[model samples]
Target: MSSGFDPLHPRELDLPMAVPLRADGALVDVTSGEAALTMDDGKIFAAPSDPAQLDDWRAQLVSWREGARARHGVPRRYDDPASAWAARCFTVAQVWLWDELFFDFDAQRFTPERFLADARERFGGLDGIVLWHAYPVIGIDDRNQWDFYDVPGLKQAAAALREMGVAVFVDYNPWDTGTRRAGDDATELAATVRRLGADGIFLDTLKKADPEMVAALDAARPGIGLEGESKLATERIADHTLSWAQWFADSEVPGVLRAHWFERRHMQHHIRRWHRDHSEELRSAWLNGVGMMVWEVVFGVWVGWNDRDSATLRRMLPVQRGLHAWLVEGEWTPLAVHEASVFGSTFTHDGSTLLLLANTSDADVTYRPEGVGWQPLHAGDTADLITVPARGIAAAMQVTGTEPAELDAVRTALAAETPARDASFPHRRTRRLAPQIPSRAQLAPADIRAGATVRTVIVPSGEHVLTVRHRARETGMYDGAPYVDEWKPLPPRLHDQRTLERVVRLANPVRVGVAEVSAAEYALFLDAIGEQAASRDPERPASGVTLARAREYAAWVGGRLPSEDEWQLAAVQPGFRRRVPEVWNWTESEHSDGRTRFVMLKGGSAHESTGSDWYVDGGVRGPEFALKFLLPGLGQDASPSIGFRVCWEETT
Candidate 1:
C-alpha cells in the first residue's frame, strides 16, 4: 500500500477541513474538528470563545478568501448561471441505481416517481440524486462502467428526475481499468453524460477529476457539476462546484465548512455513509449552510437514517426551499447560536433571515432567537421559544420588514408543528426469498430416461447447520448492516474473511447436478424454447446468465437452482464435481429488503479484479465460501464469471 493511504480510514492530517479563525483574526488551516473521522475526534475549530468577537473572525475569513483567490487564481465559475442548480441543491441522495425504490424488479422498469415519493415523505424531498451504478458489482464482468450507465432506460430515468426539478448525477468510477477496454475514460464518460443529459458527475474515489477530465466533462454538456468523493482540494473548489464531508467531526461550536466558507455558492454536502446516527453529519450540513448526502443503502448494505434525522430534514427542507436565496446566497453567520450543546447558523438575504439550529445533546433545548419577529419555520408555530430536540435539528425564520407570500406559506405550514421526537434508527434487514419450485421428480430428464443419465448427487431431507465463509466485504452475507454507527472501518475488520452459520432444511431429498450446465446444454434448452442466446464455448460451463434466466433454465429442466446450503451439502458428496474453468454457482438464496436485492453464490470463480478491495472477491474456492453478489438491473447482472447448476426434488 503506497503511502498507506487507506480509503476506508483516512488520516486527519491528509484531510482538508474547516479553516479555524484564530483569535487575532488570522485563519489557521487545522486538520481536526469538522475534518476528523467523527465528531469531537480532533481539535476544535480555533475561533473566539465569545460570540461577540465573531465579527472579527468573519472579517478574517473573508480576507483569507480574497488572498486564496489571488494565490490560486480562482475563476469563481459559480458566477455562471448554467450550474446554478448545484448551489441550490441542499439534499442529494446517493441512490443505488438498482435500488428497489428507484427500479421495480418485478415490473422490470425504472420508477423515478416512486423513488421521489419516498424521499418526499421520509426526508422531505431530494434536490439532486446521484445514480450510483457499477461499483461493488463492476469487476464481475468485462463490461466497463459506461456499459452500466448505457442501460436502455437510464436516459428516460434521468429525464424524469430532471423534469421533476431534481438534478441527476452519474457516478464515474476512475478505478475501472481491469474491465473491458473502451475509448479513453474522458471521452467515454463525456459521451455517456451527454447521452444521459446528466446535470452532474459524481467522482467515485476521487478528490478531484484531473484537469483534462474536467475539461472533457465540461464540454460534454452545459451545467455539468462535478462532485468529489471526499473533502475536495482547496484550489479545485472553484471549478468543482460540489463535494461532501465524510466522517467529519465538528467542533463544540460547530466550525465552518471550509469550501462553503471560502465560496458561499460552492455547495458542500456532509455524508457519513456507514453510520446509522446522522446527527453529526446533519449538524455539519445545517451549520455550514450546505447539503446532505442521503445514502440509505451504502453499496448494498443498508445503513438507513433514523426517524429524528429524517424528521429534522423534513422540518428544514421547506424553509430551505422557500428561502433558497437566503440559504445559499445570503450572508452566512457561523455559530449563530452556541448555547449548551445547541448550535446554529444565520443566513440573511434581502429582508429575510433563516436560522438553522441543531441540538447535539440528548435532550430538548428551548430557546427563542434574541430578536422580535422570529417565527418558527420548523418548530413551535407561534413567536415563542422553539424546542430543538435531543440530537435533532430545528429552524425559524424572520422577515426583516415585510413577509413574502412564499415565505409566509412556509412559515404557516411549519408553524406550531413540533419536531419528531423518535430518534430510533429505521433499519431494513434483507431476507432470503426462497422460491417454491414445481417438483418434476416423478421422471428424470428425457435424455436421462433415454439412457443418457446426467450425473447427480443427493442432499437428504433434514435440517443441516452449515458453516459458510465469506469476506467481510461491504456486500454483507445474507442480512444486517456491515457497519453500524462506525465512523471508519479499517483493515483486518473491513475486508477480513468472516464466517456465518446457516441452518437450512429441505422438505425432500434433492438431486443436485454434479457439474454446471454446459453452454451446449443451455443452448439446447433455449433452442427448444424457441429462443437464442450467446455462448462462448459449447463444452464450457454456461456463463453470463442472469439470475432470472438461470431460474428459467432450472425450471425448464424440471428443477431449480440449488440454494447455497444444498449446493454445499452436495459439493462434499462423492458424486458431485465442478465443471472445468469454475464460475460462481447461482443459488436460490435470493434476498431483498424492498430497497436492495442480492443473491448468494457458491463455488468461487476464477476471475478476480486486483488493485481494490471494493471489487467482488474472487478465486476458486470450496463450497463453504459464499459470495453475496448484489443483483444489478438491465442485463448487467449477467457476468462471464457467474453460472448456475440445476437441482431436483426426489419423491416416492
Candidate 2:
C-alpha cells in the first residue's frame, strides 16, 4: 500500500495492517529470536556482542529512560525521603485469615500464640507482617464486633511478636466495600495503630484512599509506614506496594523483569511469594531488587509450600539481612550468567557489590562473574559459592564489610541441610509462537447464511508474517522474540507481550462461530451424550465446562476446537471480526511437562485489556477476578467460567 511495499520480498507480508518498520525500513518482529529488525533487503540487526558495542547500547537505554522520566513527570526523588529509605531497608510478608481460621464461631479455639509460632517457624524471621482482613467486620465503627485480635491473649501475643523485632501492620481498606466513610476510616486507622501498637497500615484496594489520608495518618503517628495494595501506587500515593512478576503463564526466562527495571529502583516494591516456584520468587526478587511477601496459604488459595520452601527462605534471610543497606538502597544492575539458565543481578551499596544468582535449571550451574575476578561459584555448596541447591540461590558479596568466607560457610551448611528440588512450575499458561494460520491456497471468503443461534464468519487467507512493535530496553529491545542466538528445547508458551502491531501468515481460511459456544448448545451436547447437569440456560455463554466436553460439543456441531493461530486469524482477519463474549475460550492446544497436561485458555475479555488475546491456563483456578478457570487434570477437570466455541476447517 506504500512505496516501501516490496511484493517480491522473500518474507513479504500482504496483511491488512501496517507492519512496524525500523528507521532503515526493516520490519520489527518482536517475537522472533534471531533478529528483531529484519530489512526488506534481507539484512538483520541483532544485539551487540562485544563490550564496546554493549556499552553503546546501554548508553542509548539510559538516554531513553531519562527522556521517559522527564516526559512522564516522574519526580527524581521521593517526597518522604526518610520513609523511602526505610522501605528499602526492610522486607514484608502477609497473613490473611478469615473467620474460619482466625476466630471460628467458638471463641475458645482462638490460639493467637500458635498462629504466631507457626509463622516464625515457617518464615524463619519476619521484618514485617501485612495482616490482611484481620479487622473486626471489615470496617471502622464496628470495632465492637469480635475483632481478629479480640480474643483473650491476642493483645499480649501481638506485643510478644513486636518485641521479637517483627513490625506488625494491620489492614485499612479505605473503600471498606461501602461499609465505612473516609473520615471514619482515618479515625479507625490511627486508633488501631495505637491500640495494637502497629508500626503501620496496609491500605488494601486503595483506589478511593486519598493521599491526604495517608499524610494525615503519618502526621498523627509521626513515623507510621503505609503500604498500598497495587504497584501503581508507586506513581504517587503509597510509601510501599506489592509488585509481583506480572507474567502471563508460560513466560520464559527473565519473565516480566524488564517491566519493573526502572520503577523498582524508585519505589518500595514487594511481591507475594505465592503460586510461582520458590526459586523463581527468589530470582525475581534478586533481579528486580524487590521485597518478597511470604504468603503460603490464605483462605483456600494454597501455594503448596513445604519444608524446602521454608529452607529456601532461611538461606536468603541472613544474606539479605547482612546486605540490607546495599540490597535496599543500592543501584541494581542485571548480569548475564554464563553456561546455565541463570537469572541474577548485582546491588552496589557504598563500595561493596552483592551478586545474587538464581539457577532455574535442573543441574548445577557454574557462574563466572564478569569484570570481577571472583572465584567461579560451583553448582552446589562451597567456600566461594553459597550454593542454594537446585532451583535455589547463591549470593556472593564482593568488597563488602562482611567477611565472604564466613558468609559462604554459613550459607553452604544451610544449602547442605536443605533438600534439593527441581524448579517448581507455575500453573499459569500462555502461547509462545503466534498460532499457525491459513495458507494462501485456503483464501476463500463468502457471506454465509446461518441459523439463529449459530452465527458464522469466513476469512480469506494469505502470506502473513507475525510482527509486533516493541520498546527499546537495556538488553536491546523489550520484544517477545528471544535473545539473539538464543535456542530453546521446546517452543515458547506465551505471546501477549505489548505490541504496536503484530502480523502473522494466515493460509488456512476457516469458518468460526460468531460468538463463543452458548449454554444452550453445550446443554444439547451433554444431553446427546446422555449426560445431565443441574441447570441449562441457553442464551448465556456456556461456562463451567471442561476441555474434553468442549471438544465433544464442537464435534457435535460438525466443527472442532480452533487452533491458537486460527482463533486469532478468525477473530481479527478483516471482515471476519465478530463480537465475542467476555470469557476465556478454550483452545485445542495442550501444554505438557513430561508428566502433566495443562489445557490452554485464551483471550481474557473481561479482566485483561480489551482486543488483546491474552492467555491463562485452565489449571489451579486463576485469580479471584478470573471468570474462566481450569484445574490440574487430563481434560476432565471442570470449573465455572471456562468455556469454548467452535470453528470448522473448510477446503475451498
Tell me the TM-score of each prediction against the true structure.
Answer: 0.90, 0.49
Each candidate's clash count: 3, 24
* lDDT of model 2 at position 49: 29
The model with the greatest TM-score is 1
Clash total of candidate 2: 24
Summarize candidate 2's per-residue lDDT along 479-551 as a digit string, tens digits.
Answer: 1212221111111212322343345555667677767776766666566556785556666677767666676
List the candidate 2 regions with Cα displacement exceeding 4 Å. 1-61, 64-91, 97-117, 134-154, 177-183, 237-251, 255-276, 336-340, 370-388, 400-419, 422-652
Off by over 4 Å in 1: 1-56, 412-417, 436-452, 533-538
TM-score of 1: 0.90
RMSD of 2: 18.1
lDDT of each: 0.78, 0.47
**For residue 399, what is the lDDT in candidate 1?**
75
Any idea what lDDT model 2 has? Answer: 0.47
lDDT of 1 by residue, 276-337 (tens): 77787777777777789898888888888877788888776777767778777788877778
